[model samples]
Target chain A: MLSFYICLRKIPPMTEPRINPNVSVDCVIFSFEDDGLEVLLIERNAGQNRIEDDLLALPGNLIYEDETLDAAANRVLRELTGLKNIYLEQVYTFGDPARINKQKDQDWLHSIRAHPEARVITVAYTSLVKKSNFKISPSSFARQAMWVKVKEVPQLAFDHNALLEKALEYLKHKIYIEPLGYELLPERFTLAQLQKLYEAILDDHFDKRNFRRKVLRTSFIIPLNEKQKGVAHKPAGLYRFDKSKFHKI
Target chain B: MLSFYICLRKIPPMTEPRINPNVSVDCVIFSFEDDGLEVLLIERNAGQNRIEDDLLALPGNLIYEDETLDAAANRVLRELTGLKNIYLEQVYTFGDPARINKQKDQDWLHSIRAHPEARVITVAYTSLVKKSNFKISPSSFARQAMWVKVKEVPQLAFDHNALLEKALEYLKHKIYIEPLGYELLPERFTLAQLQKLYEAILDDHFDKRNFRRKVLRTSFIIPLNEKQKGVAHKPAGLYRFDKSKFHKI
Candidate 1:
């Protein structure tokens, strides 16, 4: 019952079982914005052509037979956002026997000229970067590239929902170990921004005093001489992260 | 120039570039033993007359066209150790182009009738198990299954040395968050044994008094009435981990 069938725009057809349609890469790109922590997803128009056509899916592509997994992830990211030097960390692998056997999935694959019964094993990856760092443009296979707040994600195409959950869990664990909250902030940000980043990712709140005290003890969160500007209320002092001092909280 | 090749005795030969040799799984099984912190490795006699013969490698196999990555890891672990229901955490993916193209690697894959130019992407996993809980037996692909001290590991086959390094680095980070050191100790162990386990994995010394005080503060470390018997020196008390309290280190 293990079968994998995948077809998307800009991706060359992987109809030949001999070409390893069994392997692919899925990305859960995370970025912080004014709304909150969001994930990048692509929309596909499901017309008479495919059953799952109109659903949203994570931007992904089959790993080329000659390329490494990291390369495949970078390619997909590059193709979708035109971003280079994107770093992807492995999160998990989704290889359920019927991952691609859903009726809608079958229809989509069949409509796209892929072997609908193919079993695909995909390596999922996670990337956290400042959303402003790159401009995103949808690739050919997708009708639109959208940044959806993690809390508001609807049912995704294929097994991307599960992939996204696992990536978020990994990121939650990672933030406490490494002072990576800075990646989600502006070049010079207020302490409140850093705390909010943690709250947004962990989905919880920390007492202001306790949070400030803990962050100050880390040494890496350096207070800048500058403060927030053009604000109606009292502005908070801005801070920057010193990469060299990154260690245990 | 970027071709990839890999070979192991118990592993089935994957020659057809059309068969999708692009995906694989590798397991790094860790357990505490009398010698120290050890990792399970399988010895492959590549051939009776081959340069790479007798090299040790982490137990691994290609992701089958029909199975999930977790199932594949479980199969490899079961084949070598006869244990089922083993849990594996995804570590990382090693997709460096040079992963399987070393001179010794080229010769071994060539000797084994495998296409030395095929690229393979392997998802790596790490599992920490209580050594005494399972019975280990070498499978057909491996001449012998051995548990060597992590520190004493020699140059391994494929890019396993790099794989091992990443697994170790991950475990080090996880230990600070999870009180998993107990998995490597005897059911009823003394404080000394616990301290030694931490020292072995972290590769650093801990002040005995501080270590004892810190461990005692954790609610999960339950003190038992049991103590070591018939030792030359004073026997210390035993303790066990309380799984229910394993949250928020």
Candidate 2:
């Protein structure tokens, strides 16, 4: 039986067809902060029956028919989290007819979707944002939007857990090639902080001395004249990324 | 407005729903040979009207609802080309609503698909195949399956040209990171052949002496005892990739 009556945001007038029931978009939004690597999740609210109510899922919804995939991703993120202009990269598409065959999933979809039995193909995306950049407040059908550490995330709704795993794998591989870790940090940060970010994502420890030596050699990681303040121990020098230098290299 | 009625292969009986109209899979199969890097394309056959019927496209079709995205990609490749076990990598998913909104495209879809107006989201894959490994025979709706040099390809159907561009960019970036170019070569190849493969993919020339010197320094490329057979010029030494050595590094 359906446990919740999830109401999606009403669509505005569009020149093209209203919405494509067969296609949806999901996002694995990641942020780095005091809790290490964290991912944004939405807790689906309960209804009168209140059965199996604590379902957590990535912020996602069916895409509007007129919008492109990227636009759909952005709109979904904004509607669920009250955040916009996020840097989202398309990771993979998940399309198995049995994806929603589980009774609980079917029941949940029955409550929300017009066509509950439609085989939805979701285009998944990976997004990175600074922890302090935006405030999150759940909207539409979501009860609450919150950040959970990647390691501590419970079994998510739909195939979201698999999506999260793929996103992490993408991040792991991408970090080695690109300086994407900086997206999670502040404008100015220390080498230790940067190393910690890498360690959290890679789930491994690095020799402090060697890590610093290697990072300093890169033209992008420029050491600023500033230093850390309000620390009980010795202050660490601050650094910033040089985008022009990175592009040149 | 209909031109040619494209007849798809009959589907096997399944417990789940049949083909998902909203989801399709397209392949950008690439092979490196005498004419340089070539991509496999399908030429749609002409009908009685034959109006705008010179359509060329990536070998693709709507995916069965029961199969996963990867399985669908493999199956689509086999159905259209009569080739199996080809290594495929998912490059991207294109879901622009206007993608098939063009008049000719709409006419093409109307002639073939049951729900001609349905928005289709295609998950595109990039495949690498050796030229001499297998033969290609067009099946299903494809009038002809043929390899066209990447440079000589004309405007393709739907958003396939954009998909091909993305695949080419992926190949260019991936060649520098991984030794994927070997998938297009035989067990034994000469240094000159290797250099030519790189040149064709990168669209840039390399100093032969310097390129050979750098290649020789790599642990993975091992020089074989045999040399090229029956060449007008002096026979060159052959080399093979050492997978174990690559993994070790």
Candidate 3:
């Protein structure tokens, strides 16, 4: 049997000193809030390995040599956002050659050169987490990390805007087939919050009566004996996703 | 905006050689016959560039440069099978790294070195085509190309046997959501042939009455005014896939 290191070394060298960029994982963490669906964004450091010093982008990192892609994604979430045990799925591998070029800055090139150890080809992933669980770190490279409404996400660095859009599309497609909505909201959430999350990602208003009926028909949501508090109107009964009944389509 | 070629050149070299020796696409091009489901298989030649000598394998090729994964797949199907415009989809990307190492000959490495022009990262894609349509070319390296029963697929070279298993799994999954079975048979076919095709892939005995009921429920089957001519049993009604409705799902 070929040893692992020999197997790794056996890969043919490129025709030239070509950079076969290493694979990394980027997480688009989404959460449901009172306003609408929100995504976590981090303010990048202004210099030294920071491409867009002031720009916002998804939390991401290079995969370790020994880790699986999913494991790398979990590590990123834990390290960056101080949250764990969230629902994460591989969305797509963004290999369009133009992705890095879209970031028109000398700083980007310098940053890449500065970190010769990091050859990153990011595999974008999406995670749905409860908004309350995060304790965003004020890391040296990031000034702040906060959740912003999906609609208000501005000019993000790299191909992040595109990645976010793809993630949202995936979210909409998955919501119909899988019980993914539970990941975005609190453990016990009002039906209205759930509906708003759907509407935000779907970008259309659903008839409240029809929406409730369709969700209830899935048989994965269980109405709890709990109710929301501090609302101006009648408090809606809280519901939770029944994990036992949830199956991927 | 970066010029396309410039954009391409600026991208990092594929970290490893673009081709992985293990992964590959083995097409199971099915054609309708009087008896049942038939798939195309080729007898490989042992020329300098010909990798699989004196063995049978589904028509396949390695993934290529700057190509969309799907495009590379279509290219392989067209080149090896001489069939185009057939239904093609990425069934899966297999990366059991140890699979290549398990082969005793390590002929895959010699094959890679033999063809300096070719970079072989085998990404296997499965395509379903009406068996009647393909015009097999008599290439010097290939001894012969012929239709074979899915039940008796020859011992394939490399990890092709595993790839075929994955393809069959994908076909079963796709059959439920899409009208892909029609691609395997002729434009017009008896219900028995359709049932047999399903049985071949699913590898289970399905009740004819129940299978027929489910097939008809799909509403994408258009019953023709014709019937089977020389069947030993009752003449079955012929049907074609309703193209307009087939793709809607």
* Per-model TM against the reference: 0.84, 0.88, 0.69
lDDT of 3 by residue, B1-249 (tens): 569989999999867535422224556666645555567777765566565344676777654434555665566666765666766665543333244443532564454444432222244566777665667763534457788876778787657787777777767766665666666777788788888877766666799999889888877887899998987988989998887776543
- The CAPRI-style docking tier of model 3 reads incorrect
- Error of model 2, residue B170, in angstroms: 1.8
Give the candidate order by descending lDDT: 2, 1, 3
True contacts kept of each: 0.64, 0.86, 0.00
lDDT of 2 by residue, B123-212 (tens): 999978897897998787677899999999999889889999999988986787777657988989988888999998888999999999
Native contacts retained by candidate 3: 0.00
lDDT (tens digit, per residue) of candidate 1 on A71-138: 88998777765667888888877878688776666666666535556667788989888888878887
**Which is the leading candidate under DockQ?**
2
Per-model DockQ: 0.40, 0.66, 0.09
- Kindly indicate the candidate among 1 and 2 with the higher DockQ: 2
Model 2, C-alpha of A229: deviation from truth (Å): 1.6
Winner on TM-score (1 vs 3): 1
Q: Tell me how far the alpha carbon of residue A173 in candidate 1 is from the true structure, in angstroms, after superposition.
A: 1.2
Write down the DockQ of candidate 2: 0.66
Ranking by TM-score: 2, 1, 3
- Which ten contiguous residues of candidate 1 chain B have the minimum total lDDT? B1-10
